[model samples]
Target: MGVTLLTGASTGIGRSLARRLAARGEAMALVARRGELLDSLVIEIEQAGGQALALPCDVTDRDALARALASAEAELGPVTRLVANAGGGEPTFVDGFDSAAFEAVIQLNLIGVANSVAAVLPGMLARGDGHLVATGSLAGRRGLPSAAAYSAAKGGLANLMDSLRIDLRGRGVAVTLLMPGFVRKHEPKPGRGKTGRRRSKPFRVDLEYATARMEKAILARRRQLVFPLSLAVAIGLTRLLPFGLDARLLAGRGRRRPAAAQPPRTRL
Candidate 1:
């Protein structure tokens, strides 16, 4: 079987997807900035009777990514699937401006993804057998106030996947845009854990459920997969709302809850 290379393989959805794919007997090349984490994941998968090659390379470094791909091919095989999953950005408002943070966000969230795509796609096209899967967000469908950079990057990613699908349609390579909404990775929701681990509160859509949906879509080469029927509906409504109202409605969801209002205490 050809290798499946996944970026951001250290944690969250990327890690989960890697585990699932490996369990299904898919050989994998795991990529992430965290060397130790990638090593651990590879060991776990191998111990479970799977094959994996851990590659610790910063996606933002284009040459590093290319080298990593070469390494994977040498060890595992040609990558038949590319998962562009790593991304991060600092939340910024127009008032509290930080140019450095803004640029860093754009570089990591946008250029990093593009670099990964460039690295593996040529080989896939030449072989005429591979798939490109990317993670996009509901925020990409509309502008979210404090998350301008985040939305912009994901939106670009979704569009890029679409264009790539068209550009390589005849080559037998396909692209899948995995669009998700509000994934709560920091905390687990109640009832999510079987071993009594603290589960995060359920966000717009549960990650596990969404990942399964994504897997089927990828296998079928679906152009796009957006989750949470209601959320998609809400986004549809956004297009119809007047700017003043829509933006305001979208603004409140991302607001930081003020630190618990402290009561004034008087000591006797």
Candidate 2:
């Protein structure tokens, strides 16, 4: 396998995917803002006999991201696979719209992905062999009740990947978009509190399963991969619903919890 560079490698899905890829002995360049986490991950991968380099940088900064990509290429070889996975967003309520917050999300989710692609596309085009993959969300299929900014960002990312795929067709660079439903970081602890109680996450899939499926899609160079199959079907069917009824059914369901007040954590 060729060198693979992934953003948002510090935590969550990004971290899980890195582990899976590392286990397969792929040369890796892991990028994220959290230096400590990335360092620890590098140690873990190296200890496990995988080759990896940790490059800590914020994806929102195009210059920094470019530098990170350069460092990765210098250390691990040209990045043959680029995963634009750095993204996060909190609730955006229409009643209290925060332009700055919305802009931040767009920068991170949409523009960040573009930056990653721009940093590596020229080299990939020159070599005529590479893969570009991104982590989109099931929420991108439609506008959500309280996550307007997030939904818009993810939707734009999906469209961006689609366009890239079309433009790069038959050029030897493949693109894949992963649209996943709820995926938990870990199992909830029992009897801690109401908050600790396992809330029902729609069609939630474990991290391992999600990463495994994503790996298969990447390897197959699939255009789009949505999961779990049940949620994908549900989201597709929602498109047939009348707007007014759909709004009513989804209203109040996505209310932002006050405790979610912490600025969105920057991760994949």
Q: Which candidate is the best by TM-score?
A: 2
> How well is each residue in 1-268 modelled by candidate 1, as lDDT tens digits?
6689999899878888888888878898999999999999999999999999889999989999999999999998888999888876656557656677667766776788889889998998888888888888777887776677777777777788878888987898888888877664544446553345432222355568767787777667788888776777787787798857887776645534234554121100
Candidate 1: C-alpha lDDT:
0.78
The reply for model 1, stretches above 4 Å from the true place, is 186-203, 257-268
Q: Which residue pairs in model 2 clash with each other?
A: none
Minimum summed lDDT over a 10-residue window in model 1 is located at 259-268
Quote the lDDT for 179 in model 1.
81
State the lDDT at 268 in candidate 1.
Answer: 5
Model 2 lDDT tens row, 57-87 = 9888999989998899888899999988888
Relative to the unseen true structure, what is the C-alpha lDDT of residue 73 in candidate 2, on a scale of 0 to 100? Answer: 86
